[model samples]
Target chain A: MMKKSDLYIFAILIIVCVLKLVQIGYSRINFSTDILLNSFKKNYGEHIALKKDIIEAKKLLIENEITNFNLSEELMSNGYFKQRIVEFSYPIRLNETSKAVISLRNKSNTCKLKSKLNDLKLYEC
Target chain B: MNVKSTHHQDSKLLIICLLISSAIFLNYFFWAINALSFLKYVNFSILIFLISYFLVSREFKKYNFIKLFFLSLLILCLGSALTDWDARSVWLFHAKRIYIDNDLYGGFDNYMPELMNAYPLIAPSLSATLAKLIGHWNEIFPKSTNILLVLPAVLIQCFFLKDSKFKLMWLMFILLFSGRILINGRTDGLVAIYFVSCCLVIFKLFIGKNLNFLSIKNKKINRSIILVLGILFGIILTLLKNEGFVIMFIIFISTIFFKLLTKRNFSFEDLFFWIFIFLPIIIWKFMATTGGVYPRIIGFGIEAVYSESLTQRIIIRLTDLDNYKLILDYLILNEKFIISLIIFGFAFLKNFKKNEMIFKFVIFNSIIYYFLLYFIYLSTPHDISWHLNSSAHRVLISIVLLLTYFSILSFQGKKN
Candidate 1:
């Protein structure tokens, strides 16, 4: 039912679609498998694994009835780290206005030490 | 005239999508009225009923690909961490608040002045409802609401497949186009799918009958289906994301503008679609405004009007070629954009007369959408390069998806 010229266009469409599928299809399979395999192995993504300490420390803060907190100078130096901590332990405010301070590097000042978790130390700022 | 041939399937898909979208809104409504304690049960009831209905039906066999794709995304989402920064801080964080406290305003009282809480609540509200279903939140399952919201959009695309070749191509196209977004628990994928679907619905309402591919024997029933789909697309698109809001506005304006360009007599129906589409978003914005949850940092469009230095900066950025260069590189000078443009352009050339109106609509809509992008970029309170770099790629999803879809739809490849 199709003219030869129109069939040429249809063939071209099929070719282009085939090439795209090969290009992106391979990439997707790779990416998905990596995520799936990693997820099976770790039960969570690497980012969450990296933040496991923060998660644990958040639980500690919740247990200790910490309402507000500050970050250690080393943690404060990196904006992303600061943000992660704030978001993870949100509802527990993060500012100099807080009496509680969470120190990942044990940088000491006038704040009194309250709790510790493997260099992740909490203090009364 | 085979009145009952394929139109029923199309209507079925659209109605399911409409109901699902409405259920999300209804959850918010229930919460707004302080009746959420009861509505969650009803929500669950509808969900279980739909699932049971789908499983028992013979039509389920045809949607095998959608089912498979959704299940895969579910697994990936389940094992995935809350990684994406916006997904974590803005979207899921809002869900976390709603789940834990049943209060959207709770974060504002704390140190979250940076959170854009005014962004519509469908994503967060749906996630919160999912969490309520679980009786508590896990970092794992709650974010799956992202894919739940995306499923309807993706599933509806299956209705448009002309045959097996188209279906295969459609499968590859979604994977190739959507990529990680299909699983990442963000709303960009949702926005992209819904926006394109809106375009198609508009086309079906306007110039589609003239096209052989979309001919329906029962015009009245078909019109109802397209119109309802249009209304739902408008609402869901607007509420999905801020980009969705801008694109929905462009769709409305583009419809009238296209009619004007074609010298067609515009009807009250055009205005009707626009009104029905935007009513939900207007109420949402009103709620944000009244609740004081609206983002104040980007206050009044220009952040610091009194500061001469800031005014000068805005002018400088708007005039800067480097910023435009970055935007060009991100928006159009990329692989996906160019490839999609090429295919759509080819289809438009080969079948120019048949697809003229919809092509014109896309062109007009895209120009206005990108112009708004540029204006927003030039007028941004944030740094220009950083703003474009962070979001330009993700923001490009909707338009790019629209192009690719139309290319597939219009690629008849047979001379009429």
Candidate 2:
């Protein structure tokens, strides 16, 4: 009961959707490969790769014992980094006077090295 | 979905669609009020969807391709990580706050200027409810709510297009205009698609042909149901985003314009309904101001119009050719808008007289929204270039949708 043109149009749409599925497959593969690479490199202080903030925040939350922490002025000023890390790292409030400070490795706080991801470091001062 | 379905069937399909719309909205409402347990909310939503699915089982069979299409879309959307700025920083952030605190207002303190500014919470609330269902947050699960919210809007249109070809074209255009936003987890796509669906409701109630009135009781029930659905959509639209309220206002003004132009009888009850629906947003604004929600976008959205310094800036920006170029880059040079224009132009060439009324209404709404966009950009409090760079393309999606939608209707001739 369908027209020839209708079938063709539907076929074309199906093809387009198939292409989207393929795109999704390719993206997820890339995402998984990056996570695998991050885990493999995490011991050697290698890259955090794409959405590195997410990985870093989750790592800190899982690894840290602190209830509150502070970001160094440099990290605090970068709006994108601050917002993403803060949003991802919930129940770990960012307090100015907290003993735990998240800082760049070279700008370490005078405390124990709690955790580090790429250049981002968690220090309990 | 079949051409053989009678007008009676079409009316029933629409009523079913409206009920589905109401169900999608309750995902947020039931969660916001905490009137239903999380388990209850999930089960209730599934139950409503099942009942609606069975009620229109015949059309569902004919339209099974759309079901598969949405499945493909959901799978694709679910696989992506949330990297978009608004998704993470604004919407999902609010969702996280609500999830952790189990209340909405505790996180309203001024934090990041971009993050703390109170945007609407419908998308976030839905996403939060979803995250609660899974008992944790992830980059993927929260954004799935965005994709799911797009369903009723898309389903409502199946009854609007008169034939399979037009409906197929509609599906294709969804990809062309909204595919990226659908995956990226923003309210812009929701607003664009939902706004068009709302406009269709407006057209049906006001401008288009009469419904299958049948018995007097059936007529009253049908009309009342349609009116209530419109109000529900109006409330949902205003709560979606600040721009949503503007889109709702344009629908109001455009319908009034059409009524005046056609010398149609205007109903005071409809006027009162618009006022009643806007109560939620008015209360929201009052809360934002009184509850220490500082520096709302009221600065750029409205206050900029009359602020002495801001008006001068707008004038200065208006004179800059590069400003015009930047806006045109997003609004005109974009591929989708150009396609919309070509389609609309072709439709006008073919059947200008037949679709004149609808065309006029669409164009009037389109023009008002366009000017408002241009003015908002000119008066923006953020870096104008940054604001335009970030949002101009998203805002223009509605216009692209409107033009192409009317073009599809135009191709159906005046019979629909």
Candidate 3:
């Protein structure tokens, strides 16, 4: 019942879908580290992790591949505004090229993490 | 066609639907102007608009597909967490600031200079409206507004695509193009939808005869109604994104050429109406520039362009095959672009003789848009490759959609 051209078109579509899925999978693996860094940087002050221990929380983030964390919402609801620069060590191997440096300034209320990735070389924050 | 006199009620209905969508978008812009003083009022108004949109979407004869589109859109929005840096750093962050401070420029300190805080506020204002309605900002509601803003354009498209085959093709196109970026609170996808829809509307008004409701022999009342709707869409298209202005300009300028080629004069009244609608954007830009919030383009300085290093940078980027290869890789990785090219090829073959002028207009616009993109890349002072890597694909998404939409319009359907 199927025409040869129809079969060919179907095959091409399947191939395209497969290629897209593989591409997405590859990007997820690659950007996982950056995503983790961003979560920490965004929620540094307003999250529950800030009230307990900043360095330990960041350590968890750096080690794990967690993409979504609401630590800030919990911390803010509990009445704590994190306003200190909490520095911790992270493996350069975690993200070979990208480096995230998060500094939570007390006076500025601005938590910024500078992340730059170019060549596949390890760097420190 | 026997001197068509009666109105095409379906076309009028389509125009009303588009107007409702434009009204909602413009409501956002209105809030942005006096956002601080009228914060609560704007939020309340936006609530009303959303409710109205839900009720009005049912007014269409075939509302099932639109409902499915929204349902799928909701699923897509909730499925993914917002991890895109641009979404968090710029768009959603701006929305959160508006929600907290109840003003457009709420958290100015958080705005990086490069984020273009002064860019038109349609996307951010709508996001803020959604956050206000939900009573809090967690990410999902604010980002969902992207799909909400595009819903009207989708509805207008559904009207044109009455055939089952065309409907299926459109659904396939939507699924293919609605990848992570579209639902992830990005303006690029919103911009693409608005620009393509605006072009399609313009084409229908000027060159195509499908909008039989808007025939020239209609009463003066109908003519004025068409003029007002055309002006409103043109303005909304310009306000959608900076590139939107360029796209609309290309369309407008090419309209003149196409009209002349066809031995007809481009309507001066339409041009005047479009400019009148565009006055708000000019005023917005003037205010931003005067307020010193807008960052001046670094590469625009003559001294910079003539600088030996800058010239070398431009030359290197222009001559590099690797840069072209990077774009190709991005396109190839996404099946949407390949399919768009294939559809365009088929459409061109089918409509080559029938709609040559409009077909040429579409191709001309695309070639010019591509060249403008390349020039921007060459002139940008940022890390050229990084800039392209991050944005080239996003912008190309718009172009591919534009081409696909044009092909759909050009294809000789039974209705056409």
Candidate closest to the true structure, highest TM-score: 2
lDDT of 3 at A30: 26
Model 1 agreement with the true structure over B192-226: per-residue lDDT tens digits: 88888887777667645443444456556556666
TM-score of 3: 0.70
Q: How much does candidate 1 score in TM-score?
A: 0.84
Cα lDDT tens digits, model 3, A1-125, are 66787667656654554454344334531223333333223332233212334444444445544222222223323322122111112111112123332222221213233221221111123
Off by over 4 Å in 1: A1-50, B1-8, B48-52, B104-111, B206-218, B263-269, B296-311, B413-416
TM-score each candidate.
0.84, 0.86, 0.70
lDDT of 3: 0.57
Candidates sorted by lDDT, descending order? 2, 1, 3
What does DockQ give for each predicted structure? 0.22, 0.24, 0.06
Q: Report the C-alpha lDDT of model 2 over A33-113, residue by residue, as the tens digit.
A: 343233212122112223666457657756877777788888899887787677777667777889888887678477888
Winner on lDDT (1 vs 2): 2
lDDT of 1: 0.67
Ten-residue region with minimum lDDT total, candidate 1 chain B: B299-308
Candidate 2 structure quality by residue, lDDT tens digits, B295-405 = 445463333334556678789888889988887887679888888989988987887777677777788888999898878888776667788789888988988998888
* Error at B412, model 3, angstroms: 3.8
Q: Between candidates 1 and 2, which one is better according to DockQ? A: 2
